[model samples]
Structures are given as structure tokens and as C-alpha cells.
Target chain A: MTLLQRLAGSARREPRGTLRVVDPNPLNWLYITYNTVEEPVRVTRRGKVRPAAMSSYRWRGSRTMEIRVRPGGRFADGTSLDACSVHRSFTEQTRWHSPHPPGTHFNIDPRTRAEVVDERTVRLHLPEPDGLVLGKLRATHVMSERFWRDLGFGYARDETGEGHW
Target chain B: MIDAPGPWASGPFTLVEGRSIISTEPVVTDGEDRTWLQTEDRSPTVRLRANPHYWDRVRGPRVREVEFRNDVDRRRALDLVCDTVGEVDIVTEVPHREAERVRRSRHARLVAVDSVRALAGAIDRGVDGLPLDDVRARRALNLAVDRSALVRDLFGGHARPLAGLTPPTPLTALHRAPGRLRPYPYDPSRAARLWQAAGGGSRPLRLAAMTDWEAVAHAVAAQWHTVLGLAVEVRILRSDEEQREARRRQAAKEPRDWDVLLLEQGSQSADVPPLELHRAFVGRSGEFRAGPVDPKFERLFDHLRSRRSQLWQVLAANRLDRYVTDQALALFLVAPRVLYAVNERVDFQPYATTFELADTSVRRGHWSLR
Candidate 1:
């Protein structure tokens, strides 16, 4: 299995495993590992961005993409994950400065709204047609709207200091 | 958010930050019997301990705990890691001189990858009294240094001499099609002529660089002093805030202190090359420090924004690369290869660049001790 698959599987099977790693401090670990809860449209490995939570996504034209979420997804909070939640997560991402650097956004600022076509379908709207949309999309992670509204913009830590969706 | 302290983490492991250092602990308790603990020693040494909570998927960091030491001195670091008592598992940032020795040694494994960033110097045309206001002087400065020799001696032949902004990597080479690119040749006599024409004979030049890159400052200072017979002194910027302030001062067309500044630009794949250019050269906040602006280059970037074809986009980027080089906006320098050393006992896979691992590569948790 790929390291990511193993990590995601580990997160599912056991929320705690002592896996020691040398920290490179390159990208945010939150977005990089453990994709069982909130997953990005794609994850990069060895320079290639591979699809993950998103089954298939394509640009409608230059500035918009029709995104299809994998069926039967659930947030760790036991809340059903849907297209509206994905749209809300990304819209929240652009509002405040994300932990990611400015150039990381590639000027693909999602404004106005991402149309929730259906329960499993989302249409992302970009400011303009950006050539870098694919790479930037790889960095955008979905967050639970319930968590974002109740606890705060970031992940909530349980009593044990464990992060919850 | 720009002001957010940390990104909401959703991973198998969670970071435990200490007063001075940060450590990671697994969040998912699989009833595994293994643990991972780390403590920092203020400087470079990081002590790793096997937690009883750690569940090992891979075998053996045989020693109960391993110490990782960081030393700028390559030979000394190698010696410590090779020692039985020290038991240093890894050495970060080894110097180029010890690459051969580290490669041959059985104690430590040498880890070197081409640095995604390049070290280059930019001349400030906005400096009130500096002769660099003339494009010829900037061109003269670019021609004076022998980048090939600098790469050979300073980098131990482990870097590629960049003529333009983009290094010819598998991804960046797309922006550097053959025949369209030209780097300033090392020609001191012609440089001398340009200097004389620009009336810059014996003028004192101040070069500013990052404090972390003192070695780069000295190397550039030495090259300019020896090659062009110009008096050059290097100044180190204490922090990023200071660097930004200086860039802002230059962007606002305010008088600047130094004539040349050593700057670094990195490309981590995707369509980032154009964005980098837009940040450094085109916008109102663009910080090249050179007061001059080119309308033609700005037009090219606008063209870059509208184009969708990979072939056409790369062609436009290459044109921008050529335009920037010909203007002597920044003298292209060699992209140094990143170097690391790990003990022979450990199983590790190092990455080409650090930023690439932020989302995908597993640098931790999966590595096993042999």
C-alpha cells in the first residue's frame, strides 16, 4: 500500500499509533496526511497530484469546475458530508488568509459561491481561468461546516488534545 | 487565515509544541505498543526516544534513543555521527566539501538533492548615488562574476549554472526552450568597458544578503571585488521583516541603502513560474529593487494570463525569462543541491525538495530502524 493509504487506513483502524518520523516542515501536516475525514480534491505524491476524496473533477470552462464527491462520505463527527459542505469549506478558506502562503492560492480565489448542483455534485467558481487551478485545488481541503460554525475556523481538539472534524 | 496560529490538523499524528521545539505524537490509538518522543537541544541536536506507546510497523531504531546533530562543519558532524558513543542517526545540511567523504563512509549516508531555489544577486537602480541606474552598469555587474567557477568551487560541482531565472529541471525546462535563452557570459574585460562607460570606476558598492546566507554574501562580494576591481562590502538583513521593509522602500521609489542584494527564488512545479515573476517584477508591490519598468514585459505577463495552451504558456514564460535576463534585472546564479546525511543503520527516503512534502511525502511515522 502507498504511505498515504497506510496512514489513512491507520487513522481509520486506530486513531493512535506511535509512528516516528523526521519532520521536514515543508507543508502543513494537517493537509498532508490522514485523509479519512476531510480530503482534498487531489493529493500530490512524487510531483504528481493524484485524485483522492474527489472521484472526478473537470473544468466546465476556464473559471469553473464540475466536482463529484465520492459517494457515502461521512465526517468523523458522524455528520453526512455533501456538496454544500465542500463549497462552504472552500469559501471559508478564501475569506481569511489560510496558513498557506499567498502564492499557494495561485490567484484562484473562489468568490460569490460554488453552486451545489446536488448532494454529490459541486460546481467551483474561480475569479478567472487560472492555469494553476489543478495544483491549487490539490491544496484545498474540505472541513465540516458544523465544526467551522460551532467550535471555530480551525480543528477542535478533544479533551485528550486529539483533533476532531 | 493569514492570522491563524496553525492549520486545523487532521492526520494520524498531532504535533505537540514545547517552549522551544515541537514534537509529534500519533493521535490514533490502535492499541499499538510503540511510542515516539523527541526533544530539541536548542541548536541542531534532536534527541529521539521510543515511546512505549509507539507501535512499530517497521523494525529497529535499535538504540533506545538517537541524537540528530546539525553542524555547518561537514567533517566534524560526520565524525560525531560515526562515533559509537554519540550514536547520531542523522546529520542535516552537510557542506559540499565532505560530500565525497560522506558518500564513502559506512557510518552515515549522504543525502543531496538539487535545491529548488537559486541564489542570485539583484542590483538596486533606485539607490540615489549608485551608478547601477544605468542598464549598462547592471549588465556589467552581471558579466563580471564567473558563475561556472563559483559552482565548481563553492558547490563542489553539484549545481547547475543558471543563465536565466528558470533552472533547466524536468518541469522548468519547459520554460527554457532551446535557442530562446541566453545567460550573461563571464567576460571581465567587457565588464570593465561597460563599467568605464557607465562611469563606475572604483565606486564603492554595498551588497545586502540574508543573515542565514552569510556564505553567499561573502562569495558574491569576493567575486565582484576580484573580477571587476570594484570595492564591495556585504551586509546581512537580520530578518524577513527587514527584507520586506527594504523591498517596500525600493518599491515606493524611496532612497535605498545598498546597491546589490542577494535574493532567492524557488519553483516547486505547477504554474508557479509566472506567478513568481508577477510578484518579483510586474506589480506595484513587485520587489526587484530595480527602478526601471518594461511595458513589453508587462504585456507578455498579460498574455500569459489569457493563454491556456501548455506549449504557448511555456513559450511566453521563456520569453519573460529572456527579457529579464537581457535587462540584467538579476544576475543568474547556480542552484545548489540540498545535502543531508543519515546513519547506515536507518531506513529513510529523502525528498528532492522540502516544500514538496507538505501535502504528500511521508517523512515521518513510516520510517523504520534497521
Candidate 2:
């Protein structure tokens, strides 16, 4: 199949083959296989974001959130996407500067602290109550530990070491 | 692949041959210079093969291989898809002028969706020698221009006139009650009266717009000139560098060269959280704001952000929308739709937000090459 796109000069930077989950953020291109949770259980025709990855989430208090991860999820590298890995991913995003693009954040509030509660649960402690955290998390793409070790904070470049991975 | 460790894509498809061009340049931010490496895919075509290890391999990527052509001209691309001979399965961004042709074509169908995008003129209330600082003057300007005419003439009736900063999307429709939020009707006499009372028209209003918006800007300038008898000058920002420079100046609070800047504002998704749009266009540090920050607006926005319940948040957002509209903070124009030309042989369903082809498949009997 052949697809034709008339992209702007700036938009032509990224590969066009990737399936961007129809979301508000144009860069939210986290492939379904790379997600720590399941593909969204349901995305409304109107484009509403529903639970997919984390089975359910609740605000423990004003500043704390408890999220239950869907069990048995794995990264492309074949590593289990358990609660500890989710915590680690959140912590890493807060500690390191994103190499993807300027002005684009990891969507994790830097002031939040991630703690693993159990095998399938993680708790986030935010400095202040943020209602938009869940929406932000939807935009945050989780990468495998191997991805971090190999690519560091920088994007994965092509064979010629040019384009983003 | 030559030597890279991995592309390790977990998506429905994996990159088969990825080629691109890169350029590193220095950009200044906050008085400090930093190196920015930019990459451009100079390759005319990129091929992707279905990933066998994909999570839902059974239901995902029915087509084994997908090829994307990046260098096709917009008009020619539409024509190719509409051709009797199937040149391409799907061609996106069907030009508005050629939409009727695509509609009349038997080989292709036009898919149009109300996108989460809106074009508006950002009024610089703080600019010197401009009377836009007065709310009455701003309201006068908004009332002067005919949004319906712009939608019909410029957009070929593919857009809806905006009543507020946000477009009429499904999410926004929930918040805005009919008749509660009405677009400012074109009233040149009332506009002239308000302009005269506010002591406007002392100097020509300078309008700055990018090349893509040059035509709309000129049309608007002409309207303002004829309606309010206000002298207006339209300046086109021809290059990206020029736009960046203009934005830098706006961010630094330096003397602005233009009184009104025409720009598009919207989320990439069909369902956008109203708070996101507010922060990007109405917040004090908003990227597209040409007007001075209003403390009152910020307070309301902060209140909206603090709400936990979705209903309360939406109510607060509606209040903010009403406040902006009443104050005439920006000249809200039209909500444009995303158009696509898909071949008849392909069963393609267009998403309102992004250009997605993951579920796209050819018709039952059209898979084989003729």
C-alpha cells in the first residue's frame, strides 16, 4: 500500500510510517507494543482518552495518586513492565533532560516522586494537586531499560546516525 | 542496516530503510546560545514492514508492507488518488479548491473532519500607538470583520466561524450551550461607533502573519480598513527564521513591530482538554499570545486547573471562554477541517486528529495488482 502525505517542512523531520495514537499531542507516537499498559481499552470516536495501560487510577489524597498497572505487559526488548519498571521510568524522566525536542517534556511533573507499592501498583507523590496528571501520563511513553542503556537520553538515530529512532 | 544498535520499534510496523539529512545550527534562548541539531528526511520514499511481534498482530497491520511518499505535491497527490488507475491508496491534505473535483471523482472520495484547529488574530494590547489596549477598541475590531465571508471565500465553506478561542469540537460542544456563546455578528456601523468612541484610528495598525496566512491577513486588513476606516498594514513573515525572531521579540517584552499577529491555534487531537488550549493561548507566558497578560484571566485559569471533577473543570473552562470572548482578547476567526482524498479501493477511515493508517486496508478484490 502506498500513502501520500503533504507535510510541512518542519513536520517532515520524523518518519511518516509510525502510527501516532490519535491524541492531542502530535508527538505521542508510543507504539502499542512499547506501552507499559494495554492499548487503550477504548478510544471514543470523539477521541476521548480512556484507561488502557493502567487498569485503574485513583487519587489517594489531594497530592497523591495510586495507579494499578495491568499485569503481564512486556517491552519490545522482552522485559516485564512491572510496577518497579514504571516507577523507574517516571524517576528517570524527572532526573534527566529529554533529548527528543525542545519545549517537549516527559509529561511527568518534575516535582512528583514515584514509588512502587507492589508488583502491579505504583504511587505518585506530587508537590501539589494536579488534575491533568493522567492526561500528561498518556503522553509519556515508557522505554525499556535497554533503550536507556543504549540510547541514553538521546533519540535512536538511523544506521547513518541521522534520524530519530 | 549498517551499524546502529537498533530501531527496536514495537509499533505495528518496523522501519525497513530510513534515510535522512541532518543540520546542526546555533539557536539563542534566554540570552544564551545553544547548538540545535535538526534532521530532515530527504528521502522521497520510506518503506515499513509489518511487525510480527506486534502486540495485536492478528488485528493490526493487515497489509504486509506500507510505503510512504513524502515529496508529492498536494494538488498532484489529490489528482493521483482520484485517477482511474490506482496510483496511491491514500493521499492526505486535499487542497480546498480541488475538493469539489475530488468529490465528483468516482475513483476517490473526499474525507473531511472537523479538526481541533482554529485561526485567530492575536491583538497586542500593549503595543505603543495602538488603541487596542481599550477593550471597546478590541471589541470593535472583532465586530468589524465578517467571519462568515472569510469562511466562505477563503476556506471554501469548509470551516466554522469561531465564537471563542476554542473550536467547536465534540469536547468543546459539551461545554458551550447553544445561544449562550454566540459569535460576534458583523456590524460595521456599531463597530465604527465603538471605534470612534474609543478614540481609535490615530495610526495604521501593523499586522504580522506568516506566508501561510498572508491571504487571510490581507483580507482582514482590507475589512478593517473599509469597515472601521482604520489604516492597516500587513507584513508577511516569509521564513521560519523571521517568525522565530518575531516570537523572540514578543517573549522578551521588547517593542513590538506589529499590533496584530495572525496565527492558528489548536490541539492535534479531536478531543483536547480545554485547559491545554488555555495554557498555550491564554496564559501569561503563552507562546502565541501577542496581548498583555491579564491577571484576572490567569486567576480563573488557575482555578480551572485546580478542579478535580471533570464537570467542574469544564464549567470553569466555559467561564474562561466566555471571559475571553466578552473581553475580545483575540479576533476569533474560523475552525478549519482536515481534508483527505482516499482511493475508492481502500477502506480508509479518517481520524479527526492525526493522520493514522494503522487500520487502513484495501478492498476485498482490489489487493492484487492489475
Candidate 3:
């Protein structure tokens, strides 16, 4: 609701629902919606969302920062957020993780992701909820940690050009 | 629907009397009163006044010269109507706010008939069948599309938008929530899992789409990278070639041939199994790719083959919505609407669905110049 409240929200967790969950503010709402390997493939989320769920760090709620990364290359479920995962999101998707560098016009807060509780469960957390905030998230980007590492920290000078950022 | 327009040289008065386009001034003498028609013109504007030398159907009076001036600027023209420039009538291209303004004006009456058209999630071309075997991946793709923006921008808050392919037509049966509607509007992490579950991973998806809609295709490709972590290859082809390729993939009935196609075809035009089947299932030779199906889509397909009633078709369309959205054939974007504004006196019927050619025939004779 206010600047102070928004900053305070990042220190909290998120909630889930059955059938469907219309997220009020999905941008910073750190959460996950996964399916159980079990039959019916019912949607599941983190047992308890944590504000600092798995983020390596955080910004002052509004300013963008740079998260320097290197390549781990290989990616699979258990693949650590290495050079490869981070690189792809950067080079391929033209994004970064954790604190995205300056001029990052669009990106999912790289500092965002869920820690796997098991083969099925993944927890979530968020910064805050606002109509304008989440509404703008409709046009943001989400890249894996591996993508950033591979890309290092290159930024797109001109998005119109078809080149690696 | 048809484009037979002119100052209608054959109607009344002659264009020879006017000097410029969008701005025409004509002198009219009805024995009781005289008025001059002067205004800027553009956007399908032409005026029709009393025909003096001609003879035609009469509302009350018989013969006089009709002035047809193009008041392409809706506001100024509408203002003239509000001010009543001596029976200066017929204004098409009336703004949304002025839709009521003209109605309230003493100079003219409004003939409104919800002519707004919604152009939501339309596939540029229709495919014959499900391109992928994975229903989850299909749902993921549908969810990745931005339907709310379309609802907000296209309809101007005048209509309800659905996130299903078949939308909420009377014929629709299956319905699903717009999972992941906003915030992270296009979820690639979830999409990756769905793709993997649907027999993918390792390599990126080659999302197929026409080149004309480059932005939409790019958005899909970017989302694929995040969700499925796949390198999506967007391809563009001519409309006819695109149709040929898409139908071939749909008809091939093989998942290996095509992964996904971000289409833009008219979604809510018609509802019937025969119509859909002819296009998606039992399509023309070499026009489909999603190969054979279970007894379900087949049975449903068969039921749609018959000519159903309008009410039946509406219900069927709603049912088809579930099939397409769930089956991943189409994700309802927005129930898009077309936008246009005309002068105040232009009481011609507005047709958002069909071509807006009759916007030309808004003459004083047919137009009630109140």
C-alpha cells in the first residue's frame, strides 16, 4: 500500500490455492506452482513461502543491480545455478539473475527462485503486491541462473537489434 | 460489406459543386429553409441532402438536392450536429463518448447497434489438429499468451474477454481458468516442465508462427526460452504457403513435425464440428499435421459435423473452447473488438464483424436528419 509496507512485504512469504489461484501481484510474489509426479498431476506449491526464500540477495525494493555470474553450462532439474543456466538466460534470453545490471529494460528479478523441498515441493516468496506493479510484470522476462553465467553481464544496447545482450 | 460508394453522383447534388475533399460546402434550398454544409472530411465521409432534379423514394417530401459532405473529423462534425446546422445531418465516425452526445443533441437522433468487434486471441491461420501430443505443454502455451491486455485495450472496457480459444460462445463446453493470468504473465519455468512432461527438453522448441506478427512470435519464443528453456525458432511464410505448411503439419497427425504455432485467425466467427473438422481434423489433402485422435475428439468431431442450430452452435462453440484450450490447439487471447468513429448525423448501421463499406451509404434520404 505504501513504500514502507512494500519493503516490509519482501520479508514475508506467499500463499496458494486449489483449482486456481489468481495472483494479485505475481511480479515479486516469490512462489512456485508445480505438479506432483503422482497421478492427476495436481498443482502444488512451496509448503511455506519465505520472503528471502532462496534469493542470494535483494535490492532496496526499486533500484536495479548487477549480479555477475559465470557458466555452469549444463542444465537439468538438479542443475545448480551455474555458468550455463545463467548464461543462457543472458545470452539467449538477454537477461540476468539475482540483481540484474543497469539498463535491464525487462527481466524477472533474477534474485527470484524456489528451493526444492523434495522431488515435488518448491517454496515461494515475494517483495509486495500492487495492481500497477504486477500489471507491468505481464511484460517482464524470466531467465535461469545458468543463462546469466554464460552471458556474464552483457546488456542490450538496442533491443531492436537481433544480437546477444 | 460491399464497396459501392461515391458522393453517389447518381443520388442528389453533384460533387462538381464542392471544391475540396473532407471539406465541402453546399447550398440547399427547401423553400422553407436554406442551409450551407461546410466541414472537414476524411474517413469514409460523404453527404446526401435533398435531390431537387432527381426522383426517388420519399420519407415525407419528394424531390430536392441532398448534400453529402465528408466530416471525417468526428468531434467537430458532431459539434455541428449538436449545434444543428439547418438539418445538416448524418455523421459517421462518432467517438465513443459522442455516441451518447449525438443522442442527446437536439440536432440529431442516434441509431446505435453495438457494432463493436473484439479481435482477441486469433490464430493467423488455422491448423488441422493438435500439433503436440502433450496437453500440458498446450495449456502452458495458452497460458503464456496475454489475454487481459487485449481485453482492456481492444474492447475499451465494453465487453467481456475469455481466455479460451472457443471463448464463451454458446457452443463452448469445456472451460479452464486463465492459470498464470498476469504478474509473470508468460511463465517459462512451468512451461519447461510441461514441455518435458510432453516429451521435450534438452533442445529448445521451434515455435512456428507467421512472420507478419513478428512481435507475438518473438514474445512466444522468449517465453519458451524461460519456461521450457528451449531455443524457439520463429518462421514466417506467405499466407497461402503458411496455410499449406500449417495444414500439412496438422494433417500429418504427427507431434514430431510441429511443436507450436502462434496463430491469429478469427476465433469466434463460427461454431460447428463440420466447420472445425473440415479445417482442423478431416482437412483438405496435405493440410493437417496433428495426426489421428482418440474416440473423444473424434466423437466430438463427429457431433460437430452436423449442421446445428444457432443456440446449439453457441453451446457447441463453448464446448469447443475447452477442447482447444485444454487440447492446446488454441488459447483464447481476447474477444477483440474493432474501433471506429464517425460524424453525428451519419446514422448508417455499424457492422464490426463484416467489412465497413456501407459506411458510405449514410445519405440524408436513408438518414433521418432530425
Candidate 4:
């Protein structure tokens, strides 16, 4: 092989692990990964929310949301992910941890309540119906409940400082 | 609670951060055993390998790794591609001035496509004591801008003048009425008439613009000055972050800081999610950035976002564009062409949304070393 070809060959390994991405624009500090495709959501390319983690979702009169978590979905740490986790994720993200400044961006109403309906189902009780409810749910990054509880209010930490979920 | 620490990731590649990441050796992911290496030179050369576990074997890990070198100094990157690099697969965001030179280079092939990027100046009607609050004053400013000259002179034929916020792609072009295809042409006499009618000459106008496009902003200001004797003040923002901060301040209960703010906005799609556009213009749910909502604009935005059918959404978008333009809520600038250089050998697939790298993937096994 030619030198360039050999250099390429040497870099290759089984289950090849290299995809370098870059952007000249500096990331927003508030939402560091906002607008970046780093976070994958349960949404199809057609802008419809799908059941990657949730088996199904439906709106009740445009105000209440019922989402069914898919069974057998596990977190990176091998814990089973369920409806309570999803509820916690949405409640925390939209209320306390949103990057938007108060009154500036569209925020989920504070009156909204995410309650665990069952082991695999969660129900969101909204004060009023919102058309962009699906879109709002898609933007939420569901975190592992165990890890979230352990870490408290800060980010998940790794020994090497190189890991984030 | 909502964010993550840097050292952990779920994607195929683990980031090794530095002034630039240099991946001279391969590393495997946690548990997946997917081997990949991402390295960068200090000047910013990014080399990436595809995961053998997930990548389409028939299409690519095409050869091995894809190397990208980014430099704000385009000339240096151009030199690397033209003179020193051996079959470097791709180069992106090339300025139009360098297109001809790069086209002549034997080492790479240049491809130019229409970009989704559009430019517009959002007039802050909420700012107190500003003539921009009057539609006639806003119209005078919009009429004064010679968009054709700005595109030709500032962008060096790299852009097309925009009539609306959405780039005139197949998806978004229909949202604008046929007559609205071109923004109001340079009409000094008409602009003067509007300025006079709006009582425009008494006070100076303050304009907030992005630093990169400050020259264009200045030129527009100069046109208004000459045509209508309007004294315009310009404040330049260094980046989008600054503009967002300004918008946030504007959205507050306090009075807005400036009369006109020039900003760039890009959409994920043309209009699939009309709610985003709705929230942006009318300050629906308190997301108002245009500074002071016009009652008509607010009504149209609500009507547009409320529609469940895509057909109605498209129709509403058309009406919205015409109304916004006529009201002079925003002055549409040029939509730049996305350009890139690629090695003739690589079977590269370029997506229109260059900002999202995951969307642009090469076909597997389509590349061979000569």
C-alpha cells in the first residue's frame, strides 16, 4: 500500500471508532449541546416523536400527555429505565434546569405535573393544551434517574473526567 | 441536572479535547468495542474513522479515515488542499473569491450549492422614542437597502438576495407570494417620501449588527443617511451569543436597548414545525425577539401556529411573509451559497445542512486508493 493508504490502514481497527466533527461557532455555555446533534431523542426525521424509549404516546384533549415507556430499555449502567425516570427527567428539565432565561423563551408551564401512572407509563397533567407538546417532549434529554439522584444538582462525573451521558 | 460532564459520551467516538485533539492512535468505545480515532492538529486538522460495528459496510468506512482541516484563515487551508495534501477528501465553507482558484486546482473538485442561510434585520419596535416604531420609517429603511449591490459587492456573487426569512428552497419558496420574490428595490425617492411622512429626520437611529456583517450594515445605514437624511448609529455584536443576550434583554419588561438588531437565523427544516417561526416573531409564550409585537403580526402568527394541517400552514406562511415584508418588520438580506472542495476520488455525500455533520455520510466501500 502507498504511504497515505498505509497510514489510513494503521488507523483502522475492528468496529472502527473514528468520526471527527467540528464547528467554528463556539457553543452556548447555557445549553452547551443545544442545536448540536449530540443528544439523540425519540423523534423521527419527519418531526414525529417515536418510541425509542417510549413504546407510545398520546395527548388527552391536547392538555394531558400519556407516554408509555418501552420495556427492556436499560441505561448504560444496566438499570431498567421506566416511566418514573421519564417523569423526573421532564419535570426537572422544563422547570428547574432549562437554559432559557425566565419569560424570554417558551417554557413549559410551572403548573404542569408529571406523575408516574404505572411502571412503564407516565402522565403529564397540563393546565392548558399546548400544540407544541410533542416537540417539547422531544427536546427533553431523559437522564438516568439513579445517576441523577446520586449526582444531586451537578453533572454526572467519571473518574477520568472523560465521560458524560 | 439537565447537562452532562465532558468525559462521558454515548456516541461512537470519545472526544479527546485539547487546544485541538490529535488522535494518532485508535481507541475503543466503552463496552461496544468499536474502534475509532479522532485526532486534530493544532492548526485544526480533524481525522475521523468510522465505527466498524455500526457503519454500512457496502457503502463505506470507504477507505479508512476522513480528515478535515478547519481554519478561519481559509487561505492556509486552501494552500494545504492545493499544494501539500494528498487526496484530502473535503473542504467546506469556501469563500466565493477562492472558488475560481480552487476550481483550477488539480488536487480537489469544487462543488457549490444553495445554502439555507438567510440574513435579516429585525427592527425593534418596542424600543421607545425610535422612529422605527412607525411602519413608514421601517419601510424607508428597507427601501433604501440595495440588496443586489450588497450581494454582489459584499459576498462577491456568493449569495442571492432574499425576499423572506426562509431561504428560497423548494420547500420554503412557496411560502412567499410571487410578487414578494424580490425585496423592495432601491428607490431613493420613495424612501425619502416615507421618511418625510414618518417624521424620520429628527432623531438618530441606533442599529445593532453582527461584527462580520458590520460593513453591510454600515452601507445600509449610509443609504438611509443619504436618501432620507436619517442619522443611524451602529452597534456591532461579535457573535450569535451576543445577539441572543440582546434579544433576552429586549424580551424583558424593561425597554429594549436598540432600534434595529441584525441577526442570522437557520431552521432545521423549511416549515414543518411552523410553531418555531411563530414563537420567534410574535413573542408567543414570551419568546418575542422582534421587540414590540405588531397586533397584526401577532394575530397572523397565532393563526399560523394554530393550524394542524400542513396545507393551511403553508398558506398561512405565504400570508405571513407578505404581511411581515409590507409592514417592514424585517429587511431580508442575501442567502449565501454553500461551497466545498472534495477530492475527485472520494464518493462524498454533501447534505444541504452542513452544520449537522452526522447528516453528511459517505457511501461505504466506494473509495479506493490509487
Evaluated on the second chain alone, the candidates' TM-scores are 0.71, 0.86, 0.49, 0.74
Predicted candidate 1 versus true structure: per-residue lDDT over B1-370, tens digit per residue? 1012222322222222211122322211112111111222223433333222222223111223333233324456567555432234455556667677778876666766655556677667666555777778888888888888877877788777876776555566667765557568889899888877888745579988876567767887787777778888778899656866665555455567777777765544434465554336433335453566657776767776566566777787777777778777776777676676666544444444332211211123323321
For residue B298, model 2's alpha carbon misses the true position, in angstroms, by 1.2
Model 4 Cα shift for residue A42 (angstroms): 7.9
Per-residue accuracy of model 4 over B90-112 as CA lDDT, tens digit each? 56666666787778997667777
lDDT of each: 0.53, 0.62, 0.33, 0.54
Candidate 3 residue spans exceeding 4 A from truth:
A1-165, B1-131, B149-162, B167-192, B238-258, B267-290, B293-295, B305-313, B341-345, B356-370
Docking quality of model 2: it rates as incorrect
Q: DockQ for each candidate?
A: 0.16, 0.15, 0.01, 0.11
Cα RMSD for candidates in order: 9.6, 7.4, 30.7, 9.7
Q: Is the docking of candidate 3 incorrect, acceptable, medium or high quality?
A: incorrect
Which CAPRI category fits model 4? incorrect
What C-alpha lDDT, on a 0 to 100 scale, does residue B241 get in candidate 1? 66
lDDT for each residue of candidate 2 in B269-364, tens digit (9 for 90 to 100)? 433345445555556645556666789898987787677667776677778888888998888888887677776666666555545455666664
Which lDDT value does model 1 have at B76?
A: 60
TM-score of chain A of 3: 0.23
Candidate 1 residue spans exceeding 4 A from truth: A1-56, A70-82, A97-107, A110-112, A144-165, B1-101, B104-106, B178-182, B238-255, B281-283, B287-293, B345-347, B355-370
Per residue, candidate 3 scores C-alpha lDDT tens digits across B88-164 of 44444343344555556665665432221222222322233322445675666655555454434433443345444
Q: Relative to the unseen true structure, what is the C-alpha lDDT of residue A146 in candidate 4, on a scale of 0 to 100? A: 55
